[model samples]
Each structure stands twice: as structure tokens, then as C-alpha cells.
Target: MASVTFRHTSVTYPDGSLGLADIGLEVREGEFMALIGPSGSGKTTLLRTLAGFITPSQGEVLIGDEVVAAPGRSVPVERRGLGMVFQQHAVWPHMSVEQNIAYPLKLAGAGRAERRARVAEVLELVGLGGFGSRRPSQLSGGQRQRVALARAIVRKPRVLLLDEALSALDEPLRADLRAQLQAMSKQLGLTVVHVTHDRSEALAIADRIAVLDGGRLQQIGAPDELIERPASPFVARFLGDATLLRGRLENGLFHAEQVPLAVPAARITPGAPDSTQASMDVTSASGPASRGPASSSSAADGPVNRNAPLTGLLAVRPEQFRLTAVEGSPADDAAGETPAGTSPVNGGAGNTPSGGNAADHLTNAPSSRDASTATGPGARVTSGDDDPPPALIPASAPARVLSSLYGRHSCSARIEWSGLEFSCETALWRPQPGQAVRVDVTAGTFYPLSAAGSTPAARQEGEHAA
Candidate 1:
């Protein structure tokens, strides 16, 4: 097995169009690295460059310590010690599986007996034992694909490249094949680079994923890291169903038109001059709740300035939002009476009220009262005492359900609040359209609009400021 590296690699076509732009990445030996992006995002171009089908216009391509591609010089594809599978299972209809698997060995001048032994070995390895004599026309699509895989690995090449190898199969078949491919790679300790457009597939199969867009490399990391801490708005939107809200960060809170949420201090990275502290108090609906000391000296992590208000974007995933039905709302009382066993405050016997605390329904949420409170745009709620109430701290916002999609396990609702639409997961509560709901954001990641190293497209997409 061998590691692969691309250093400052670029590909410029004859029409002056750029296919890859200054790409740099490394695939460790025996690592399953997945390359993923939308169409025209340079994923295939990078793979082709590595396979010697396309030479880099600049920079170098190295396999292990040997520089195989550099500028005008290149290595022949046949001598690269790489095996590749494409979207189409290009098996010959007239050739038997054994003949197909043995073709490479024949080209290498292996004797007949040796070729037969190697073909039998790989056939059993790919779970196609004793099916070698079956013609491609007689085999199922999945079997044909297995034959293709067997042919590719028969040579025992150092690197295996898979370009949408399972895309042609059905979902169940694709899943089965994916599991098989993953096991095969590990069992053989093969260095693999898989190019795929399926986000879930890449997340499930690869050790690390590299994202690309507009001929440039986007963020690359483990699946959880990309989902939890995306480097840019595009990554957040692409990798999952995340809603980007235009807002400003002030006093350690993210404030939109009507949605006010306490930003987790850990998500705040230090970059701006205004950043000088790392901790901030998270205010609940009732009153101020102490998070920790606000002094930068006490923070174990570096400082993050929350004193100055900065325009930015907040990315919220569906699961991170807790939705609670509003009490006495038109949708809830549309029948002109409360449901048989439910009430306004404490849900009655064997009943769950729409107005009940959201935490009672979802396991991952805090109490709806403790999470946030619905307030109008720029409206502040006080303790309702004679003395002046503390400044309105970040909490929750009121929303109206626009549509609902019922899944087998949960229901996802499209909600509108302050002229912004968000997709939220409603656990066990089937909210109807036009129902008034309260949206409580349990967690969110903030990215300043002016953050450095962000792509122009990302900045433009995240500029949904109200």
C-alpha cells in the first residue's frame, strides 16, 4: 500500500477553463478517503489527475515518495499500480468472470495455472466463489459489479480508486455493496480514494472526507466534525439540513429580528480585535443564569470577544431546535374546545398537551421555559416588578408552522418566524399547518460575515442579514 499526495496541483483545460485550482491534500496509506462535491465541483478532475488521465498544469502528484506527475512530465497509467472502478460496470458480455479476472495476469505474462489460482482466490475474496464460469449476461447487476471489483483487485494494486461504483444500483443494493467494499478495503489494507456525490455514503464509509466547490477545496474533516463545526456556511448547508439565520452577535448572544439565542462560548473562535473574553452568562426566560466567570484570565480556552456587536450568520440544524405548541392559539383551539384529557398547564391523564414543556417530549432538550421565551421583534420582557427589569436576554422566538412532513420516526415542520423559514424536528408532537409554535434553539454555530479564509460564495450565501 502507498499514500497519495497532491501539492499545489492545478488543472487548466485547453479552453482556458480551470478544472482544479491549487489543490493540496494527502491520503494516508491504508486510509479510505472520500472526495465529495456537487456537479462541476472538481471531484472527478482531481481523481483523474491522480490516475494519470489528466496531468497537472503545475505542482506535483506523489504516490508515497515518488513524484509521479509534475508539470509536463508524467507516468503512464498502466504502470501506476492503481486499480479503478467506474459508475458503469464495464464487464464484457461474452467473457466469463474467470476470463475477465485473469486478463490482467495474462497481460503480465502469468502462466495459465497461476492465472487460474489468482482468479479463484479473488473470486472467493469478493464472495463470488464458484461463479467464475458464469457469463456477464447471465449475472445480476450486483453480481456483475462484484465481477468488476474482482477484476480490479486481482492484480493486488497498491491503490484502489472507486468513482461512483455503487451509484447504478438500488438503495438497498448500494448499501450492501458499500458494506462489502468497506470490509474488502480493510481486509486487504488497500489504500483507497472514493469519489462520490452522496453525502451519507461518504460519511458512513470514509475515514475522512474532502469537500470541493468551484474548483477549490472546501473544508475536509471527519463526519462528526464537519457536521458539528463546519468551517463555512456552505459546508453546513451542504452536509446537513441546516438553516442559516442572518443575525448579529452582541453581549455573547445571537440576535435576529425576533429570534434571540445564547451563543455557546465554545463555538466562538478568536479572530476579531473586539474579542477579549471567552465566557458569557446564558440568560434563561426567568432571569440571568450564570455560565461561568467572564474573565479571559480564568478561561482555559483563548478569548472570544462578545462585547462588540458583529454582523454574522448562525447555522441551526433541525435536531438542535425544540418546538413547543403555543397555548390557546387558533390552531390548537380550532375546534372551539380543548382536547378531552389535556389542559393549559399540566397535561391531563394519559395526555400530552401542545403547550406542555418541550423537554417532556424530547430527550435532548432543556425545559421550554428554561430554553427560551417567545418575544416580538426587539421586545424585552422584564420580571414584572416595580424596579426596572434586567435587559431582555436571548431566549426563544414565536413561529407558525407552514408545512409538516411526517416521517416514520419523527415529523419535520417548516416554520416561519420573523420572515425567516426554518426546518425543525417535532418529536412525538404532530403540529398542523398554521399552528402557533415556539422555537427554542438548543445549540448553534456562529460565523462572522467578515471571517477570513471564507470563500466568496460562502460569504454571499451567509449574508442573509435582517
Candidate 2:
């Protein structure tokens, strides 16, 4: 196991564009660090730097105590003691599985017996024990990927570099491979740096997540830590489903404009004793907010509003929203974006809280509008002779059961409440078109992301122009 470290690392390309700048990070030995962001976020660039594929214009790239990448002297990729898997399964098509796995051993000039034994061991490690003799062309996509993995670390390199190795697979196949990789990492004690843009992939697999944007590293930490407490607005919005609600704090305690809400932990690391519930906007895709001293609510709303302690930005996950068929009790807004004294759940009723947006509940929230709704033939709505066809759309805002799909053992529901699309998985649901569905959102998780830092994009752009 070898720790990979980068300090003051910066990179530039022949096109005069900057790839990265002021990079500083450390990947602990034997830990999995998943670097994620959009295509140009420099995730791949960082991985290449670690693999000794790209040279930096400034700074140090160190593995253990050795300075592998820096000014003047540099190490080559093969000499770096790192295992690498590319986006394409870079296995030699003509080589048999056994041959491919054993190739690394041969490269290191191990004798035939040792090479064969290591090949057998790694093939089983990647779950291809029985297919040793098959060539790459004979395997399924998953199988081929397994072969590729077997080849990557067959020599037991100190670190493993995965460059979106599973991005080409379908969702289910990708999920399966993710599990296998996780298991393999633990068993092998391999330090890993995986690069991808898939949010779910990063969330499910990473021990530490490094958010990169525009070729710069934004924030790095554990999965829940970054999601629940983002260091900036960019980080919050980039990682997952999150919406930014603009609000302000009054007198350093309550948010203005919306119902009274407390400052976020980012704002007041120690929320007062009375602060309890953090609110969010469900459609907003905000993450969890920090715990503070405020009246606790029944549930968290979108990290958008509930986590709305003092809102710069909120990240709300879809699963965090609580669905309701009927009206819910009123509560106060933490993010000042809500109307003064507004409660997110139920807008009106003496029992409800006051001062939220008077717009129809489905109007402002995006997830309420779904593109799909799951319904079976038998579950279709039948028109009665005496009843004029009920309006699928509301008088002003429309709600429709749009698109839905059924899997072998489960199904997903999609509905258009206002204009946004929101989907959820279920055991079974057969809601017909024009079915009146009441969506009562309980709350969302809020993550207070950093708003002050420069994203990789900015640095890259600046470097190119400079």
C-alpha cells in the first residue's frame, strides 16, 4: 500500500490550456478515493498524473517518499508501481484470460510456474476463475471487464488506477462491477483512485470523494460528509440533485424573506440551543444541512429548504422527500427564500404555518412533474357515462401520470406535478393516468457546500488564457 500525494501540482497542455492548478491531495494507502465531476473536471488528468502519464508544469507528485513527478526528472508510468485500468477494457483481444493475467508476471520476468500461479490467483479474485482459457472476444461485457481488472493488478502494484473502467457498461452491469471492485479492493489492500462522473457511483463506492470541476479539485471528504455538509455552492450543486434557494440571515440568527429559519452550521457552526430541524426544497436537490439549535420538524425537506439553516446553497436528495397523500402540519422555513413565516409542508389551514409561497404546491417544485408513471392495463382509469372526462391537468398548473416502467420484481413511478420530473422506485404501483395523487413532501437533506472556493474549471480556463 502506498499513499499518493500531490502538492502544488499544476498542469498545462500543448494547446496552451491549463489542465489543473494548485492541486493538493493525499490518497491514503489501501483506501479508495473516487474522483468525480463532469467530463472536463480534470479527474482523468489527476489520475494520469498519478500514473505518470502526464507531467506537471509545477508542484510535486509523490508516491510514498519518492518524488515521481516534478520539474526536470520524472518517472514513467510502467515504473511507478501502479496498476492501471482504462475506460476501454485494454486487454489484448488475442490473448487468453490466463495469458493476459500472466502477462504482467512475464513483463517482470517471473518464471513460468510463478506466472501461472499468479494468473490463477488473480482470475479468481476478479470472479473469472473458470474462464482462463477464453480470449477477450469470447466473454460478455462484464466478463471482459473482469478480465481487464485481472490484468490491471495481476502484479500486485502498490496503487490501482481505474479510469472509468465501468462507464461503458449498462446500469445493472455497472452496479455489479462496482460491488466486485469494492470487494477486490478490500481483499487486495490496494490503494485505488477511480475517476467517474456518475453521482450514484461516487456515493455508493467512495471512502473519500474528491469533487472536481473545470479541472480543479473542489472539495474532498467522505461521501456523507461532502453531501450533508458541502463546503461551497458549486460542490453542493455538482455532486447530486440540489437546488439553490436564495435567502439571507437577519441579525445572525434567522433567515429573512422566508419563514424564520436558523443560520446553517456553515453560518453558525454551533446552531443555538433552540434550533432543531434543518429544511430543504425537495425539487431543489439540496443535500443535508448541519444540525443546529432550532425547533425540530417531523422530517427533513429538500436539503434546499429544511436544511435551510442559513442558505447559500442546499443539496436535496430525492429519497429524502417524504411523500404524503394528504395535507401536513405547518412549520417555519430556515432558508430565507420562503415567504416570511412560511411552512414548507402544508401551506394553509390555521394548523398550517404561514408566509410560504402561495403558489400551488406542485408549481415551484420540479420533481412533482414526472415524465413517467407506472400503471398496468387492468389499472387504467375508466370513464363513467355520467362523468365528463376529468381534467388531467389542473385549472392552472397541470398534474399528469406521465411515464412509468416495470422491472422484473419492481417498478418506478414518474409523475408531472408541475413541470419537473421526479421518479421513485417501488415494489409495485399501478396508478393510472389522471389519477389524483397528493405529494406531501416531508423534508429534504441539506448540505452546506462551500461557496468561496475556485473550481477546477476556473483555474483551467485561467491557465489557458494566461
Candidate 3:
């Protein structure tokens, strides 16, 4: 019903401690905006500022077009037209659910019949239709929280605020309540701002998420955007399980000293020119020598250089790395020969050639390390199986599995490549520990460490100050 805005807002305590630092963001009308961060990150400070509990030392907080919080003037919390639910379900023990929900309408002088009708409607909305007569003392934790929710929405407020509303409930109940809350917000067209430390919850429900650290806004974007193209290393590490590799970008290819890996610059930097062809050509021509040292100039056969070299970090998630069990030592594959019974796996994203026993191809030959064992947990080892072999990447770096965790549909492995550890996921092939495998970076994002406003010192200062 109403959008929320924080325009250059800041909060400072009496002792000169900063609560928020020049924060600016907007929550669209009828949008579910989630504010997330660690403890003392200023998310709660921002929420309290919007609720009129804390006034901004400078700038202003606006609800729709009205300035509700500003220096020397502020609206009263009771008149802000906001419905709020906190971690604790603050329901009266002696009151029935219907009475608790109707109390807000009673305060506004609504007639008994009108209050009863509104209470009944919200009780049904929160999935407590037939339990309104029960007292809070008799209800389960989840039911009591639902009662708290029904009470908050009974008066049909324009904006709703949830500060860890479901954190006290169990996982299953929390998940169910999250779905119900999303539906309720849409059906009622409420502008909602939810604050939680749970990243998964925010990613699951928010139209957009605002990440804060050290009393400063880190980055705000849709869930996928933050996960795929994080603006900084802190954001990438905070949002998902990403392995950060220090590297340098030369001629549109990322070169790192920790491993023999070269990722196309285009994959790491959005909108960068596609240099996959040039990189592949260079790798084919130079073989393992390409990973040795940086060349002062681009390859004679490579494309013309358009962007300058950059020194920064590369963020690669587990799912972005493709793995293939090496039939023999990497030295054997360097001769460009496919083994006796195995075919060269295609080198494209999500491409798997048909008609091969994956276990046979992976287990038939002796590895140089002699560590290749039988199929791992949940592996299908039958011959003539429909499941195809994993892709054999030509320019992949060599790595050995240190450990593995098997899930229902996928297996995650901890691999050590060139003295660096990385986490990778495999869905089709189950690689055992000490097994030699080729690790290829299927996709990654590069962040220039020298970029403005993304300095590590600034992030560290914020974290420490918070």
C-alpha cells in the first residue's frame, strides 16, 4: 500500500558511536524487501528508524511521500500504520486468539460486530480458522505465532515489518510460515520489510535483498544477481559457498598461481568480450606452459588486446566447476589420445555423450596415483547404462579429492589443486577420495580488487566497528 525510502539516512548514538552510515535504499509499494546481515550490522537500526523508534541524526525516512522520520521531528510509532511481528510471539496468555486479534480494532473504536468479522478473516488468513477460541496457553509455538500474525494484520496496516518472526519456530514450521507470509503479503498488497540474519530465508522470499555490514550497506540486488555477480569478495563469500582465488587477468583470460587454471575473462567480468576462442587456442598451443608465468604481450595468434590487465579476485562456486576422473596420469592424456575403451568426453556445458559405461571408463584403467577405486555411494556401475560419462575438459587443471559428502542427488568433494583446496559438486559421477580428477572452471566472476568503493580495508573497518 505504501513504499518505504531511506534517503541518506544515518544514526549515531549519544556516545558518538555510529549506528548507520549514509544509508540510501527504497522498498517499492507491495514489495517484500528483506534486510539481512550479521549482529550489529545496522539492519535493525534501519528498521527501527523506519518505525519511528529511532530518529535519523541526519537525512530522512519517508513512507510513500510523507517524511516520517527526520532531524528534530518524527511521527509517533502508534500512528505509523505499521503491522509488526517480532521473534517473540507476545500474545496474552489469558486471551483467546479472537480476542487478541480484535484488540487492535477495539482500540480504534470499531464496533463489536466489525471487530469480530475482521478477526475471523485474519484468523482464516493465517491458517488458524477453527482455533480462534483457544487461548495462547493451549496452542503450539507455531499456532501461537500464527495468532501473533493474525493480530498484526487484523487492522489492515499499509506496511508490515517482520523482525525474525519465524526464528523461534522449528525448521518445517518456519518453512511453512514463510510460504504463508509470502502469500498473505501478495493477497493483501502490503509493503513489507523483513529483517533476518538467515540468508537462505531472505533469498527464498525477498523480491530484493539488502546486505549490510559494519553499519554500512554492502550491496543490494536480487538473489541470483548477488550470487552470480557479487560486487565484492565479502558479498560473494557471504551469499554462497564460493572459493576465492587471487589471480590476474591478462588478454581476457584469468591466470592464477595456485593452480593451472585459465578462465575466460568474459565469464568473470560481465559484458567483457568473449575470448574463449583465443584462450583455447593459446592453451592448445602452449599446453601446461601457459600456467608458468605471465607474458608481457598477447599471443601472436590471439586476438588484439582491448582491455588492460587487471589484478583482482575470482569467485567460483562449487557448482561452477566441472570434474572428470582421469583414466591415467595427466601426462598420458597430453599425447592427445583417447584410451582403449573410453571416448573423449565433449567439452561443452551440460553436454554428455551417450552409450558408455561410466564406471568402466572411470575404473578400467590404472591411474598414475593408483588411487582410483570402485563406484562411490549411490553410483550406478551397470554396463550399457543410460547415464553418460562426465565431460573431459581439455584445458582442465589436475586435482585430487581429499574428502567427499554424498547427498540425495549430488556429491560434494573437497579437492586439492596445486596446494589450494576447493569444493566442487558432481551429480553424475561419484569421485572417491585420493582419486585424480581434472578440474575445469565452467563459470566464474572476477572482481577487480582495485575497484573504487570495494576496498578490503573499508569492509574490514565496517566489520570491526560493528
Candidate 4:
């Protein structure tokens, strides 16, 4: 296995279109890093540059300590010890599975006996041990993909590159192949760079993920960090489903729908704990956030904004909103909304003690507008030992449920409030469409995203222009 490195690497098409712009990153030895982005985001270009299929316009591309590509310098694709699996299966249609897998060994002039041994070994590695005699045409789509994978790894190349290799299969088959591929990587100790547009797929398989937009690197991080503490509004929305609400920032707090919420100082201004710090110790000694390649234009590398009264955005994931039915209202939810003096937000009587029912405590909680509004999501409220932990703040307005979709483990409920529509995930109960429900906002479940204009569309435009 070999580590990959790009030192200020960039790529430009002959027509003057920028492919990659000053990308500096390192993939540690035996690490699995995934490149994810939208169309024309330069994910494939970066992969191709590493494969020696494209030459860098500036800087150097290195595998191990050898310079493979740079301005006016190049290495042939065949000379690079890399295995590539493309979106399309490139297996020989007329050849048997064993023959297809053995072709690489044959090209290297291996003897018949050794070729047979290697073929058998890889077939088993890909879970196709007994299908060596079958042709590509006769095998299922999944089995054919396995054949492609087996062939790619048959030679034990130093690095494996997969470009949307599983995009063509059904969901179940894709999931199964992902499992197999992950297993193969672990058992073989393969260093892999996979490119895909599917966010969940990358999150599921990659040790670290590099997010791209247009042709620029947005962020590189583990799945949870990016989800919980996104650096920018674009990153927050791109990673998954997010509700972004426009708000005005003042006194280190954001006010939206007349509800005051605290956010990270870095959200509006640069140089604060922005999205770049979203990566954490993601199963590797070399953290992806600190070591992975990042774009030169990232917020972490930009200027600081110490000034206040900025217009920013609020981001919250569906699962973060604690859904509750107002007490003594039309909906017969167990916990009733207590009077202002008795509400949890004002440190009233509704606060549940340690051993009390969890839902009951949440049910009696006050709306966000009624709380102290001193902290953001994941922040803690100081309390005396005798006092019950502060209850979550309720939504500024009670939401009217517009739709509901149920899944096996959870239900998605769409509600409208503050003249905005939001989709929230609820585990305990599924409210009916047109039903009115209350949303509880807490410092433990929300984040302040960046300014509204730093959206995916704007970033894409900037990337293309660069």
C-alpha cells in the first residue's frame, strides 16, 4: 500500500475550463478516502490525475515519494501501479471469470500454475469462488461487478481507484457490494480512493470524505462531524437533508421568527470555529481535518469577521428537532403546555427531575422563544444539583403538520411554521397531516450555518470561474 499526495496540484482543460484549482491533500498509507461532489466538481479529475490519465497544470502529484505528474512532466498510466474500477464493467465478454481475472497476471508473464492460484484466490476474495467457469453474459449484474472488482485487485496494485463502480446496480445489490468491497479493502490492506456522487454511500464506506462543489474542495471530514457541525450553509445542505432558515445575527445570537438562538461565532465571520473544524478523530491517527487536502479558498484560510449585526442562516437536521404535542391543546399529547410561570423555559414547575419520565419532561418544556437563549446546539445550561436539568426550548410558533411519511424505525413529519416548511424526524409518535404539533429547539440539536449567499449555487459559480 502507498500513500497519495497532491502538492498544490491543479488541472485545466485545453479549452481553458478549470478542472481543479490548487488542491493540496494527502491520503495516508492504507487509508480509504472517498471523493464526493456534484457533476463537474473535479472529483473524477483528481482521481484521473492520480491515475496518470491527466497531467497537472501546476504543482505535483506524488505516489509514495515519486513525482508522477507536474507542469511539463508526466508519467504514463501503465507505469503507475494502480488498479481502477470504472462505472462500466470492462470485463471481456467472451472470457470466463477465471480467464478475465488471470489476464493481468498473464500480461506480467506469470506461469499457468501461478495464474490459476491467483485467480482462485481473488475469486474467493470477491465471493465468486465457485463461479470461475461462468461468462460475463451469464452472470448477474452483481456477480459481474464482483468479477470486475476481482480483476482490479487480482494484481494487488499499490492503490485502488473506483469511479462510481456501483452506480448502476439496484439498491440492495449496491448495499451488498459495498459490504463486500469494504471487506476486501480491510482484508487485503488496500489503499483506496473512491469517487461517487452519493453522499450516504461515501459516509457508509469511507474512512474520511472529501466534499467538492463546482471544482473546489468544500470540506473533508467524517460523516457525523459534517452533519452535526457543518462549516458552511452549502456543506450543511449538501451532506444531507437540512432546514436552513434566514436570520439576523446580533450580540452573538441569531433571531428568527422572533425566537433568539445562540450560534458559533465562526458562522458569520471567518477565522472562528468554522465548518473546516467539523472533522474529528475518525478512526485514524492522522485526522482527516488536519491532514487532508483543503482548497486555498476555504473559510479557514480566509479573513476574520469580528463585526456583529451580520445576516446569517440557521441550519438544523430533521432528527434534531424534538417533536411534541402541546398540552391541553387540540392534540391529546400526554404532556400539556403549562402556563408561562409553570413552564420549563422559565425554570418553572414543569422541569422533570432525573428519574422522571423523559417524554413527560420534554412535553412540559417551553418554546425556544421563552428560554434564556444563551446557548446554541450542544451547549449546556449550568444548573444547581437540586435543580432539574433545563428543559429544551420550544419552537417560536406551533407548527401545523402538512404531511407525514412513516419508515420502519422513524417517521418524517412535514410541518409549517413561521411561514416556512420544515421536515422533522420523530421516533415516538407519528402525527397526522393537518395536525398541529409543537417543536422544541435546544442547544443540543441545532447549528448556526454561514451567511445565506454562500450557497451551493454561488460556490459552484465561483469554482467554475476559478
- Per-candidate RMSD vs. true structure? 11.8, 12.9, 12.3, 10.4
- Better TM-score candidate (1, 3): 1
How should the candidates be ordered by lDDT, best one leading?
1, 3, 4, 2
| Model 1 ranges off by over 4 Å | 258-307, 328-397, 450-466
Cα lDDT tens digits for candidate 1, 1-466: 8999999999999999989988899999999999998788899999999999999999999998989899989999998999999999999888899999999999999999999999999999888999988999988899899999999999998899999998999979889999999999999999999999999999999999998776777778888777776765556666866665655554334456435444432223322222212112111233222222112121112223333345555666676565667776644322221111111111111121112111221121211222113333222221212111124444466688999898765578888876656777654456789988776554555545432213343233333233
Colliding residue pairs in candidate 1 = 275-305
Residue range 1-466, candidate 2, lDDT tens digits: 7999999999988898978877899999989999987677688899888888788989999998889999666898888998888778878888898998888889899999998888888888888888998888999888888888888888888899998888889878889999989988998888999998788888898899998765666678899877665654455556745433333322222121221222211112211112122222223223223222111221122222322232222233333222222222221221111111111321111111112211111122222211112244212121122211124212222234455465654344565654545553323244444444444222233322212213332222222210
What does candidate 4 score on TM? 0.74
> After aligning candidate 2 to the native by TM-score, how far in Å is the CA of 344 from where it should be?
11
User: Candidate 3 — number of clashing residue pairs?
Assistant: 0
**Model 3 spans with C-alpha error above 4 angstroms:** 271-308, 328-398, 433-435, 450-466
TM-score of each: 0.75, 0.65, 0.73, 0.74
- What is the TM-score of candidate 3? 0.73
True-vs-predicted CA distance for residue 224, candidate 1, Å: 1.5
Best by TM-score: 1
Ranked candidates, highest TM-score first: 1, 4, 3, 2
The better candidate by lDDT, 3 or 4, is 3
Candidate 2: lDDT of 399? 35
